[model samples]
Target: MRLIIAIVSAISRGLGVIAALCLLSAVLSVSEMVFVRYVLGHSTIWQTEFTTYAIVAATFLGAPWVLIQRGHVNVDILQLAAGPRLRIAMEVLAALFSLLFVGLLAYAGWVHYEEAWSNNWTSETVWAVPLWMPLLPMPVGTIMLALQYVAEIMRLFVEPDAEDGASRNTLFSDTAEGTRP
Candidate 1:
């Protein structure tokens, strides 16, 4: 169980890094587009589409990292006010619901990706990027999120003292909550 959690956390952390890179690449591409359109007096082809896809990809791929970090915006007032048992219960219920939602999303995304890949879909632009390239992250990231949710559920029971698989400083592992590695 520990090994499984550790491996999933490692994968989530890796996805976080990749997502950050995607965001950074998007930013750079947008800048390049502006430079080409204004400074070089030329029209851009792929940069606009690339930026959109990269941003979307980052959002999807970064979800597991966000979940582990507890970075998604939520009203934690109830959590702060509840007793330990109630808190655990609430957290468990929430995790289960989240797991269900992400699981369905993953299935749908996989189906969509399969169709795209099978049809060899491409963008209707001059760049004509393969649709599957961007679509790949949807199912992949959501599945990772689902696995991370399981790890989170386990952490609640198997490691009660741990802090929700969250690290304030790092993108991976719960190093800040006095939990054993």
Candidate 2:
């Protein structure tokens, strides 16, 4: 369990770095676009497409890191009244649901990738990037996210209350009263 948690932690950190790099790519691409349009009096064909791909990559790649950091938006109103045991249960259930959702998404993405591969899909642009290039990231990101969440659920079971500050919420509720069911 400890080994799994450590691996998850490492993967999460790696994703964070990748997300940062993606953001940098977006910024650079946008800057180049601006420079070309203003200074060169012409638009670069690849700037917008490259930036869009970077944005998508950053968004997906950052998910597991965001989960690890508890950085994603959340409503934690009900956490005040929740007991530790209840919190653990909720965490496990949430992780399970997340796994299912991402699992389905990854499966669908794999199918899409296969179709694109068979068709020899390529972007219809000056860049002409291969469609499979971006498609590959979807399942990879989803699997990483699923692994991180699974590790989180397992950590809850193996070492309950080991890291209090690691948890973002005790239950999934919009208000302070917490989840009733």
Candidate 3:
């Protein structure tokens, strides 16, 4: 279980790096586009499409990293009110629901990608970029998120208490009040 979690963490971190690079590329491309269009007095074609795709890809690819880092927004009022055992149960339930949601999304994304690949789908733009190129990130990201969710659920079972800082960090803070469970 520890090995699985470690592997998933590594994958999520790798994807996070790729997502950051994609965002950086998007920013640079947009800057270049502005310069070329305004300063050079030339019309840009691919920059708009490329930047749009890059930003969207970055969003999907970064989702798992966000989940692993507990960067997503959460309403912690109920958690704070609950008892230790209840808090653990709530966390497990949340992880399970997240896993289900992401798993379904991954499956749907794969289906769409398969269809696009089979039909040789391309964007209806001047660049005519392959649809699969942009769509590939959806399934990959969701799959990684699902794996992270599994890791979280496993941690709840393996370490019910908040002694394991990694597990606590993902679900809750290490403050005295927060570490009760």
Judged by TM-score, which candidate is best? 3
Candidate 2, residue 155: Cα displacement in angstroms equals 1.6
Number of the top-ranking candidate, with lDDT as the measure: 1
Decide which is better by TM-score, 1 or 3: 3
Q: What would the per-residue lDDT of candidate 3 be over residues 1-181, giving only the tens digit for each residue?
A: 8788889888999999999999999999999999999999999999999999899889889998998888988787998788655677788887888788889999999999999999999999889998999999999999988988898777665554544443433344544534433
Model 2 stretches astray by more than 4 angstroms: 160-181
TM-score of each: 0.87, 0.84, 0.87
Candidate 2 colliding pairs? 77-176
Global Cα lDDT for candidate 2: 0.78
lDDT tens per residue, model 1, 42-132: 9999999999999999999999999889997777799778755566677888899989999999999999999999999999999999899
After superposing candidate 1 on the true structure, give the runs of residues whose Cα lies further than 4 Å from its correct spot: 160-181
User: Root-mean-square deviation of each candidate, in angstroms?
Assistant: 6.8, 6.1, 4.7
The TM-score measured for candidate 3 stands at 0.87
Q: What C-alpha lDDT, on a 0 to 100 scale, does residue 94 get in candidate 2? A: 68
